[model samples]
Structures are given as structure tokens and as C-alpha cells.
Target: MTGETAPVAARDEADPVAVIEVQAAVLTRNFELLRRRSGFDSQLDRAGYLLLLALDSLGPSDIGTLAAALGLDPSTVGRQVAAAEGKGLVTRNPDPQDRRRSVVTASPDGLARMAELSVARQRRTTKMLAGWSVEDLAQLARMFTRYNEEVAHHYFTGIDQVGCAAPHDQPKHSTAEDDS
Candidate 1:
């Protein structure tokens, strides 16, 4: 680890909140780097990329569904979808079940572009974590998955009622080092 990251790692072992804060900062920096390195920033903005990902993961969906899933306003999603459609990245079809609603899906070209971007991201991530052992990578993956699951559960369970919970307050688990 670099002199900069060593302090953060030391703090992470003692303070879960510190770890979370550092993780957030790292994610923000990584996202900016990825946006610059990948050509997606030139072709699509953050909202567009998120919309495409939602469509890819959730299949064809209506504007309202996409908006809710993405935590974006419906009008915002509508405009993004329109822009993507114009760029031939997405297609709109009348919902068979409801003629009044139109569902959006990625076009063949969009899928191909998304696939290319995915590969680029994977390659970049692999290179960035090149020194990490397999066990370390697996631990990171598990930790991220667990964190996301907890946040999702809290979010979907009525954020007004439950509010956000601190990571350390949730539960305790064996450290990655303990797994060895």
C-alpha cells in the first residue's frame, strides 16, 4: 500500500465508519477515472449509462418503472430515454398490455456498445486490483455485496421510517484476514 492508503487501512480496522467514508471517496475517484478512461463519457452521460444498465438488468421497462428503479424523476428518465432513442441506443415499443404506455429496451447497437463498455470496465478493474490476492478479491466482493444488500433493504423498507443505519451498528463479522 502507498503511504496515503496505509493510514486509511489502519483506520479501517478500528473504525467501520472511517472505512465506509474512505470507500465512498475511493468510489467517487474511481468513477471519475473510469468515466475518463472509458469512452462512455463522450457517448453517454451518467444518467444515460445508468438507464442503459437498468434496461439491461431489468429488461424492457416503462418510464415510471425505470424512474423508480433508478431513484430518478419520471420526467428525467423520459428525457434521457428520448435522447437515447434518438441516438439509436434504445427503442420504444407500445406496451402490449397497456397501449397507453411505452416500454423502452436497448437496441442491438446499444447492447453491443454496452457489452464493449462492460469489457473495458472489467479490464480496468482487473488491472487496478492486479496485486490483490484471490482471497482478498473475494473478501472485497463479499463485503460489497453485503453492504449493498443492507442499504437496499433499508431503502426499500421505507427510508422515512427506518432511516440509514451505520455499518458497525448492523452486525459484526470475521475480518478478511480471519478467513485465512
Candidate 2:
């Protein structure tokens, strides 16, 4: 980041792939900082946000199912679910089929909170890209989605609909580790 960066929407034709990687790493750290300093006192933390998001998309599910969807360990998901439940953001009820297991679901209150958090984040992002055109914003979103998919492909095994390997099946190229 010492020298002049490439123009917006432009790639540096001269830099090697390693240089791009380094820049990407810096960009992620910078984005994290931006999120932290955005002056929004978000009620939902990252774990809770992600958990609700997964539950919203997947419907009510057992902790193990939610954990798999979120790419988190069940223990970690359990702790998060507990915290959210304490906040009235989520609930865990006895699974109908299996009386011993609890199924976690995002409460209506949780979804409302999540929506507010999402709007706040989106506002911050819109402010940051104030001058960007709609087409540019779309392109940026597409590129980021592509990059995220590639990252998940290499690091996670249980991503659905991407033809990724199942939990017990490991792809040769993926040395699975929870880098997050």
C-alpha cells in the first residue's frame, strides 16, 4: 500500500498474483476497521448476525444442521444460540421427531433486529460508495461474490449447491481449516 494503487475498477496489469493477494489481505483489514469505526452501535454481533442469517435462510433446524450451514462447530454454534436466546433474538425448542434434541430458530424479534443491522450496514456501505454509479456497484458486488465463492471452495468442504464435498468427504485440494 506504499505506492499509488490502481484506479477504481482497474486491475494492475504489472503486479504479480502475490501482489494482488497482499492487497486483498490489506483490503479486508481496512474493511474491518471501517465497519468498527462506522459509529453504529449494532445490537447484533457477528456470530449472532451470521446465526440469524443462516436460520432465516435455512428455516428452523437442529444445532448440528445450523452449524453445518454456517461452517461452524456445533459447540460454537450452541454458545452463540445461547447468547441470542438470552437476548430474545432466537429460541431453541425440542425437535418434534427427536425428543432429546433441540431445534434452533430465529425469533421474529431477532429477524427485526437483524433487518435493522443490515440496513445500518448497507447505509454505511452506500455512504462509502457515494459517488459510484449503480453499474459500478453491481460489478463490485459480483466480483466480491466470485471471490468469496472461490475462498469457500478452497477452505470449506460442506458448502451446498457448489458441488463441494460432504463433511466426511474431503476434496484433495482443500486442506480444511477454519481460518475465520
Candidate 3:
């Protein structure tokens, strides 16, 4: 459902679980839209763009390194690199240190296209957050960074140990008469 029409449970804004759920939904939808706009729906799939970006940032890297940087499987990154190579957006070269492994890097054309896309994306993001005050933007950045770090820590450790209890296990904080 669209955010405007979605039914929200009657819960206080201070309720951590409810706030997290709503924010997660909002961020997921926004990221999906951003992904489509950033060429995921076109010739460059999300994997390709991400792979190219990683290559651009990290220079030539083997499949395993790229996969680890992008939090993807090596096989998946290999496929993405192959597809990007087919599109002339990236090139694979023999790793100097490892004869059996290949290192991937963004091609000149890919670099140029990536620069153009980055500018466009920056413009889009600026426009999207034009209504927000500087403080709000800063707060969002800080909060998002903290949230991501927490998620990553939990993922690396055990999420079950992070106290992400099931919904049914949560204490009932809402009263029937308070349904909004």
C-alpha cells in the first residue's frame, strides 16, 4: 500500500518497534524508487551498477573482494562482472599476483557514464530533500548511520541476541479504545 493510504497501528510515536517498522517501510520504498531511477530498470541492473561503483571505488579487484565489499556472493558478482563486460562497461584482466584469478575494473566509458549518473543522482537527492532543514538532514544522516551500524553488528553477531523479539512476544502497549 502507498504510504498515504497504508493502515497504521494505533501506537505512540515513542514506541520503538512501531517507529522502526514504519521507518523501515519508508526507507525500503524510497530505496526501491531510487534503485529504479539509478538505471536498475534499464540496461544496467542493480548488480551491474553496484559492481561498477565498487570497481570505481576500489580499483581493480578480484571477484571475491568485490563480492565481500558489496555483501554479495562471489558467484553472483562473477555473473554481474561478466554481464558488465558484455555491455562494455567493465573489463576483466589477469591478476598480476594470481594467474588463476581475474581482476575487474570499470572501463573508460563506464567511468564517464558513472560520473554523469552520479551528478544526476546528486541532483535528484538534493531535490528530494529540498524541504528538509539542514539540522533535519544532519539528524537523518546520523540516525541512519547509527541504525546501519547496529544492523551490521547484529547481522555479524546474532540477531536473536540483539533482542529483536517477535511481535507476539512484545508486551501489548495499545489499548483497544485507543485505536486511531
Q: Which candidate is the best by lDDT?
A: 2
User: Which runs in model 3 stand beyond 4 Å of their true positions?
Assistant: 1-12, 34-40, 156-180
Residue range 25-58, candidate 2, lDDT tens digits: 7798777876687644367887888888888878
Ten contiguous residues minimizing lDDT sum, candidate 1:
157-166
RMSD of each: 9.1, 5.1, 9.6
Candidate 1 vs candidate 2, lDDT winner: 2
- Model 1: per-residue Cα lDDT over 1-180, one tens digit each: 553543335365578777777777778787887688777777666666677877877789999878766655689889999999998999999999999999999888887777777677788889989999999999998777676656544443211111222223323355778434
Better of 2 and 3 by lDDT: 2
lDDT tens digits, residue span 1-180, model 3: 455545454366788878777778777987997787566346466566667777777788888777666655689888888989998999999999978999888999887777776677778888989999999988987787677545544332211221221112222344666434
Q: How high is each candidate's TM-score? A: 0.70, 0.78, 0.72
Clashing pairs in 1: none
Q: Where does candidate 3 clash, by residue pair?
A: none
